[model samples]
Target: MNRTLEIELIDELIALKSARGLFLEEDIGHAPVERYASDDQFDTELELVFRRRPHLAAHVSELAKPGDFLRVDLAGRPVLVTRGKDGVARAFLNVCRHRGAQLVGENAGCQNRFTCPYHAWTYASSGELISAPHFASGFPDADKTQFGLTAMPTYEALGFVWVVPSPDSSLGAPFDFKNYFAPIAAEVSELDLADHVQVANDRISVAANWKIIVEGGIEAYHFKIAHRDTIAPFFEDNLSSFRSLGAHMRSIIPRVSLARLGDSPRDGWRLRDHANTLYSLFPTAQFLVQQDHVVLIVANPLAADHTELRIATLVPKSEAGDSELWMRNHAITRTTLDEDFALGESIQRGLTSGANAKLTFGRFEGALTAFNQSVADTIAAVS
Candidate 1:
């Protein structure tokens, strides 16, 4: 290899090591109430952080394109999002202009227009009120232009969509969440996520606080106990070494397993020793990178104690068809994910019982704590 190339390789290795090495147990477990499931402050804080933080809002903004649409219920408000013809993704309240019925009910699909079912009111994809059942005479004062769907504040970035449900929200100033993610963003970019396409997505409902599901993804402390048979065999149980960002954290697990994975592989699909990277993006999203695939789970809180987890598996684009490998991979991921959801739901049940007023986050899990604190600060500021 050239001398310059060798030097660059050495630098990259050192940087990777440094990124994975600098975490403290004290940091993971700090500020217990911040992440406590029963803490009302947790919900309040999260609402503020998500609604007010412009930088955080930018992550989903960058992913927008013309006609791109997604539906979201952020902080208890239903949002219908779309990238208009001009190539800007915008979010609007999904309610119909007449009698307030929801216009779009399906999860997501491309459309040139949205038609209201109640009275057959129709609107363009850009949210313009173009037609109605009785266009000539519903009411003389009813102007089509005045009845456009309500627009919400929106921005797309970082391969995700984000929305604020309030029409009066002051989130217009451009803030890039990718920048706030900083050095970690650069490190993650090494995975070349753009080349990967979603191969499988499993949506699940969990009877737990959304944050609890997030905690389950971030910390390795529970692996030896909660996931002994399932995950422990594939990951290092020791929590001494993990990496942290102020509001994000990732754990790297080597692929070596006790199952003789290296030698016993004669088969169709086998679990191999590989680097597994897990990332918890602040309050809700969890990104898990296995050797052959990337699993992303975003938890959306439906109620104080109910949450929905959206799981998407991204595989190399070449493996697009419905092949045996795809099915096998999806099955394995589904099983592991179900197990995690079970744990999260049961934990939420325990938390709601008032048996424990606080929950302790391990030092390696402090990124969870930091995120909770960030939520607290945001809610406080908004309040």
Candidate 2:
């Protein structure tokens, strides 16, 4: 972060600490329960929001080598992202061109050429068709160029690879990845995220709407009550602050120890030392920056009521070999997040029960309100 913004955030933290209060909205916000329970609404979101936007697919470290690759399912489409010999990261539809067989069954690996299992057709890491068996006699006039894997728009920045899920979408004309993320680009760059290596990556299927899972990360209103036995002891009671960055948001939840900074000089204050900064990256990614490590939570919507939560714990490269420390941090973070997901599941069940027509977000839950509104506005504009 720049010095100006750094000082500004510190001032906000000190003010909140002095007032012993949390950030508040002008009034309460209400969202229809149908947003979370209706299948039609879910389908619309998948088409207009998730598919059309650029999603953070993998960290650069995951594909550090020239031939490294990672396979992921984005908005129900199988995607294979690879680092080619030229050291460029690219994405393609993970399906064989011959018989439409799913290619690259493993989650990740290093390979220069991938051969189809059924037809034995092969492709280069750059997504070019390399060879096909019996080409001399069968379809001799066929154009191999047309048979290559379908490519998706991919951009690598800040040590991360982002891909547009739709194969037909252009990365330049309609959507510019750098411009779309300009608001928080500096903040993310300052963290040196590219220098951190992922120490642990885990996925959990949650029985809840994806939005519910995302909303749980942007507010601290439930820190004390919902996390009473887990993380509540370390944080202040509902003390947090949030700022909107385009459609995205950045929130800070201060630790109880932040009170000690009240007596310290402003020149010596460090925000990360006393608070956890969480960045909600528009559609689905939540990045939590802690004192020693960073946690990225991505909510992959499988259905209206099912979500796959991919959690990656990234630690500084210097500490990558500290297995014991990283494991301890990962375990604690996972347990805390598991509690939030459980509550989200419970909330989903209640929404399905038809007990209420709408859900209300209180003044202190301004982050949640803003997030839902962003989603609604984006979908509305596109639909």
**Model 2 lDDT per residue over 297-338, tens place:** 987899999999889999888879988889899999999999
For residues 146-227, write the lDDT of model 1, one tens digit per residue: 8898876555544555455466435555445555566356555655556667766667888877767776666666767777
The runs of at least 3 residues in candidate 1 whose Cα sits more than 4 Å from the true structure, single-residue gaps closed, are 1-23, 27-39, 42-46, 50-72, 133-144, 168-184, 188-192, 240-246, 255-274, 352-354
lDDT of 2: 0.88
Q: Cα deviation of 309 in candidate 1 (Å)?
A: 0.6
- Using alpha carbons, what is the TM-score of model 2? 0.96
List TM-score per model, in order.
0.76, 0.96
Candidate 1 colliding pairs, count: 14
